[model samples]
Target: MMAATDALAGVLTQMTGPWPVSAAARELAAAGVPVFPCVPGGKRPLTEHGFHDATTDPGQVEAWWRTHPDANLAVPTGATSGMVVVDVDVHAPTDGYEAFERAYRAGLVSRWAFLVSTPSGGMHAYYPATPDRAQRSWQAARPGVDFRGDGGYILLPPSMVSTNGATVGYRVRQINTGPSATLDSDRLRDFLDPRPTPPPTTSDDVQRSADVSRLATWVAARGEGERNRGLFWAACRLAENGVPAPDALDVLTAAASQSGLGEREITTTVRSAYRTTQPQARPSSTVQGSPRAADGWFARDATVRTSAPGRRLS
Candidate 1:
């Protein structure tokens, strides 16, 4: 049976030039399979022609570079002074490419950067590196930064310049010089780490909390299943702000009325049933009365009112 990489090789082999390969394409290449740079011709066979002279221009190559001046071209082999190349495999959806470009531009302004788009929409960003070991040492200190000298990652043939043509070995056109003239490799490392930070609680969060509090109070006046349903609604509301389900349930039970139903019963019922049920049983058109206007003892009393203050329920 053909392996996954082999299957991808077949797909990449079929595309024409002026195309970008996604991250999946890179994997296939890394696995020793050749993928042609797709252009007008259907799948030209991969050869040394792919990485041929970096000084020559193929048809459509100049126009492609003009359109995407910020895009990087991969340096398949050899070391260039003052450039760092990072091999990145972009998966499908290519959602994060622009962000990566922004970050790269910020840190390496005035320098050339290259990104070879893989078959699956991922890219490799290449930058010029300082030739001195000391300067290069600082560049390598940053994780994910490559100096191209250490067998870091091979640029394969059939890779198109990001903007246009499919002919390989074409020199990458450098358009705008990056604004970041110096490489602060340490800061760059921190900037790229994927750790999450908690957002500061805002006035909107306070308002949401107040809304949930009022809801809990209204639910306390209701008996049994209705109270459980209210608790579930409040919990769901809190969840929109990243509150965990169990914690929201605890808060709901604590705020519920002590006399009408046991906290455990209400919480359990909410967890098992109310959480899964629709907010309202009947269609909005069929519902005759609001909870505030219903002909009930609780509805009549001011202290047991069910109406949302300063808001309408439609």
Candidate 2:
């Protein structure tokens, strides 16, 4: 299995030039890696079930490509592919290179097998998957970094994208020859987007505190179709327990952001929850001196996107 995985890794990292999408798909399948077709020039899956339709069967691979001959190539990440990816996004006003560099300097993301330059001038650092357990995918919107693990898929080299009226490919940037290392995704995420340290509970806080930390963590893990509902539910719980509106915002803003909810959406949902549950409580105009305000991490607006459970990143 290890040898097969190495060979599969080679199929991606060793490609020095463009290969026909179908050919690349076949090669990956022949290497024991399951593959699926994505919309040409885009990341959307062409099949009915997206990445869930990935298969190692040569017949299925051939059929899919025959139907969508110009389709892009993608593979399910994590244990299925024996690999994972650290996606460093580079966009206007947000660049993950610095955050990735910080992780590298801290000895957190050093063992990548290869690096793929994304069409959007971003990067994908491929690493070997940890054998003992599953590392689920996560998004740290503020840092502009995303983890492609158990519930995600990534387009491969030579897969082209239409960017700014010019076509660009997912090109291999560098391949490591030395020993490769696995990334501690959870630790890396915490470092990139550290949660605010809760302040010491005063008499006021004692009356309102109700396992805020655990509730925040749960909020952060909520996925699409449930993010708004989850945030509202958590906020209601906190409000019912006397957690102040300002305090609830401080705790949940970052968590909801991590789950891919935008700043406006988070604030609205949380405020609505508090208003619905605490009709008599006065609403504060601002959250002065809150832990989140002290850290200034939760104030920045970040666009977050998350994969559904057992689903690919969309």
* lDDT leader: 2
| Local accuracy of candidate 2 as per-residue lDDT tens digits, 1-314 | 24434666578654656588899889889888899888788776676555667899999999999999999998877887778889887534455776776787687887666667677667787788888778777666567677877757788877897877789888765555556777788888889988777888798775444478789899988877798999999999988887666657657865675565544467678888988997775443321111111222122221122222232212
How does each model score on lDDT? 0.36, 0.71
Each prediction's total of clashing residue pairs, residues at least 3 apart in sequence or on different chains, is: 32, 0
Estimate, for each residue in 211-283, the C-alpha lDDT of model 1 and write its tens digit.
7777667655655446556665665566555554444554554344221333335445545443454333221
Clashing pairs in 2: none
Cα deviation of 147, candidate 1, in Å: 7.8
Cα RMSD (angstroms) for every candidate in the order listed: 26.1, 11.3
What TM-score goes with each of the models? Answer: 0.26, 0.64
- Cα lDDT of model 2 overall? 0.71
**lDDT of candidate model 1 versus the reference:** 0.36
Question: Which run of 10 residues does model 1 get worst, by summed lDDT?
Answer: 281-290
